[model samples]
Target: MAIVLTVRDSSGLKLAALATGFVMASLDVTVVNVAGSAIQQQLHASLSELTWIVDGYVLVFASLLMLAGGLANRFGARAVYLAGMAVFFAASLACALAPTAGVLIAARLVQGAGAALFMPSSLSLLVFSFPDKRQRTRMLGLWSAIVATSAALGPTLGGLLVSAFSWPSIFLLNLPIGVAGILLTRRCIPPVGGRRVRLAVPGHVLWIAALAALSFALIEGPRLGWLARPVLAAYVVLGFAAAALVTRERRAEHVVMPWNLFRGAGFTGANLVGFAFNFAVYGGMFMLSLYFQHARGAGPFLAGLELLPMTIWFPLGNLVYSRIAGRIPNGVLLTVFLLVAGVASLAMAGMSTDTPYWVLAVAVAVANVGAGIISPGMTAALVEFAGVAHANVAGAVLNANRQIGTLVGVAAMSVVLGTVTDWNRGPGLSFLLLGGAYLAGAAGAWWLIARSERQARNVRR
Candidate 1:
């Protein structure tokens, strides 16, 4: 009875700590977006510099997540989680104090490294903390809600911080949360055993190079002209790095992205959908911020308020979907959600300077509902398709792909808008491309779902 009560008493504190880490991770994805204008003005940043400030963090975070998972497995999750929080806290301080775009980008990179360490470890801790199926589901549901809410609310929170204070306030916001999470984790979470795994060094190096070069080429392509010598060189480097990554991974026994996971129908489809989701959604969010501020001439606070429609639906939709997630087939749910998002993108594509705010709000709200639906379903499909032993690595790969999608999405849209002298045409073109990508993702999800069903029937026969 005493043990049961202790578990019950400490569970909430543990949940708070774990969710704090996740919130910090998710918040950074969008918070910096709202602060873009302020950061630009204060630092006298170029467009490429601003892009790097945002993409640099995600690039490092995505590149190192797999290695971070391995580290978590080698060291205990509790120890690694605390260490990650400490690093994240220190990095946040660095971000808040950065004086130049170069300094900010470098700090953001270190912050991503710290985030990479904690994210997977925090998930591992959550899994170990709740051994019971029901409790696990509830905890996961709570975790999902918190993460969704953070992502949803990030822009508004960032706008408020940047409006009332300055851009640095955005990074400063993470300080108190990080400190509290570290203290709670040290006090409340129990130590768990870890496994020994080999680090895939060659694969890591190749991936990091490939992604960084690709991002650089994409961001600089529009500014430098696509065929410029530097842009061409970056593309060449990207191609070589990508080819080498494939070769190195194929030959390695302990790989960062195990090719076998891709063989499963649901796993492949989940990753594809994850990529498309981030590409369109996050990219669109960045574009929307620019449109509101630059094109529409809205202030930071009002621009965030304009986005409230979509943000509000994210958490509410997640709550509603969690209740039905078990009853629905993941493939079907994923397909439907992708379709919804695609449709929303299409709706947004018709916008012009004359387009009313209500019309845009409706379209964005639909997309938020799609995001809410797909997030948890993607996780479920990964676990179901990969099985328990492979779930961790499967998740890391999916998330990495998702972050790459985010980088590509943002860079691509920025390139389009940057190159086109006409604001009226360029932004709309980006939306059209995003809509097409979302539909392609929907088709892929449907194919995987049908294949899985057929395989299930064959097995029964």
Candidate 2:
């Protein structure tokens, strides 16, 4: 028997959808990052293999995201999103029971693809559903809050699961969430028709290959010698091939990131900032956990407890910002936040076992406070300028940028650590990498806003 439910108000139902998908995606992103070592030990993965364990999913997530949005457009956002949730739950089972590093990495790759599919449409549904600008912005703010909380709490949750059960338990956690999401989705998300089209399969293959090559080169380059003929050649060839793929995509009637991605300086600038922010953010969390648990000898539960400040404070920061959202200029708020966060992170490079717990708490809190200020405002700017027709696709682009940013951040930090088990030195390097990345993020905020102002005037036409 089929049961039907009416969404009394699409706004509330959409918000519920946003909250569900954001938290689920954010949890997967952060938890796996924290559980790296547990999986590494159990699987006996080499440092190179372990690097892929993290970067592999991020890369595929970014790569397929171009396609995910298109699929949503061609096949109804609700259908694609529901399918993604199903795939995510099934992949979680594979991740939990994997006997080999190869299997885990493969499972993680599918998981990333599912995440890519789930996130964009869920967010797009929010964007299109909320008709008023103020309501839309606030809904996104609420959406941002959920994602930020999950991201902040991921380490703690990962630690708890790893400690209470085992490393595989981290992946196991997704099943119930998926089941719940499916039920909620059925009730809240309206069914809609989809566009009809043939895929740009050749271009898709080219980009996927490019992503795989680029991921491998970047992960291996630092350790294997970046200047080595083989490494340099791989990067050079991959770069050219990727360029060719873009050109081919541009000429296709059905382009992914149409050449119009460079519509103006504002779009380009905002996109760049999104990238830099993610680059350092994801890796920084992973590296810090390694420092706390592996280096400081803190138990998983204890380590999670230590990380509670970021989780608790992040939502609070959003709550504060939600109160004063429209009053503040998006650019000004973002710049100050990123600058302060960057400085605080750089300060974290000096933390030690002898350091006071209050000091660590302050550092994490400061960074998250900045995250609350910048995230909603930045996303708002991007969506406001992107327009509804392209909303799903533009949001997909943002999702890819954010994931890639995380991959780069993690990769940069890993290179600094050189696969050593030393915890004392890891934090310092992680801090430096994140600090530099945030500084770049701060610059991105300024550029993004400047461009958005012009875009706003143009859109009024």
Candidate 3:
């Protein structure tokens, strides 16, 4: 009994350390949204520049995630995790002191690189810490709740800080969180040994190039004109780099991505679900943040308050997941959640600039609850499918895809905002796009995940 108590206490401390890292990472993702207006005013940034400020982090983070996972496998996960925390801490400081929009974007890119390194390792550590399937599912739910809470609080916290101080305060907030994460990680989490895994450098480089070109085309298309020479050239580059990367990875002796893992339809579906989930959730959040300030003429503090109704339900959904996780099939749960979110988002498509706050708020709150449930449910399903052997690589793939979704989602919103001069039409259109993404995820979950589960059960019979 004494030994059991000691083990449980140790696991609790380890969880705390992991949660700190997640808080910092997730906080940055949403907190910066509320600071958009403030950052724009102070930096005198253009719409494109503002979009860059947001996407720069996601772009680098998404591009490097697979490499980071490979590195974690090659080097020890603990070492890589600590290194990432240190880098993120320094980058946050640079972001806080950025003199120009360009400087801030650069710092954000560095911050993303750090996040890519740590994020996958954090999941791997959590999986290893709780080896039992039941206990791991519970911990995953708890971890999701912690992350959701931080993200849900981001806008409100950023608003309060920006109103009281300035936009820089949002970045400054990460400093303490970073310090706590590093110290606690060192003291609590046990070190996992490294393996001799090969890093596919060429494949990674091509992958990065492809994503960069695509982002350039998407973010710059509206400003440059879709037919502009630079935009056209970027499109060409994007196509070439993507094709080359795919070919290279297919033939590589040692691949960066675990292709074998993706052979399972369940795994593929989970990745798709993760991608669509981020696309809708992050994209919708960005649009609504701007809508509150730019369309509704709200101040930073007011904007944050307005966003609270939409974001606060995420933690509640995560808590609900913990109770129903094992009772329901993951595929069925995901399908239902996606459907709820999709329908709710579609309801928001009718919203105009003059729409009542409560109306929009209720719609968003319902959508958020569904999104919140999907996050942990999808994660738990993917982890179960991947098993412990491929935990690091699998985690990286899911997160990378999700970040890619976020990058594309935000870029898509920028296109809508830039192209449509009318705030009323633009926001409604954005909601439509978000709705489509969610519904698409639901379809994939039903087709791939449910079918796979049925096949497995049939085999057992």
C-alpha lDDT score of every prediction, in listed order: 0.80, 0.76, 0.89
Best candidate (score: TM-score): 3
Candidate 1 TM-score versus the reference: 0.94
Residue 399's C-alpha lDDT in candidate 1?
A: 75
> What shift in Å separates residue 377 of candidate 3 from its native position after superposition?
0.4
**Span of ten consecutive residues with least summed lDDT in model 1:** 1-10
Model 3, C-alpha of 370: deviation from truth (Å) = 1.8
Supply the TM-score for candidate 2.
0.91
How well is each residue in 226-270 modelled by candidate 2, as lDDT tens digits? 788877887877988789887887678877674486575555666
Q: What is the C-alpha lDDT profile of model 3 across 331-363, one tens digit per residue?
A: 988999898889998988878988999999888
Runs in model 1 deviating more than 4 A are: 1-10, 449-461
> What TM-score do all the candidates reach, one by one?
0.94, 0.91, 0.97
lDDT order, best first, reads: 3, 1, 2
Q: Residue 304 deviation, candidate 3, in Å?
A: 1.3
- Which tens-of-lDDT digit does each residue in 1-461 have in candidate 1? 01121364377888898888888888887888878878888999987888888888888988888888777777767777788888889999999999999999999999989988888778767766776655765566667777889989998988998899988998998999999999888778877666777888888888898888888888888888889999899889899999888887877888877788787877888888888888887788888887888888887777778877767766776776668766777678778878887888787775788888788788877766767777767766676677655545665777788888888888888887888746677777888878877887788788985468557769989
Displacement of residue 287 (Cα, Å) in model 1 is 0.6
Q: Is candidate 1 or candidate 3 better by lDDT?
A: 3
**Model 2 misplaced regions, further than 4 Å:** 1-10, 227-233, 349-357, 419-426, 454-461
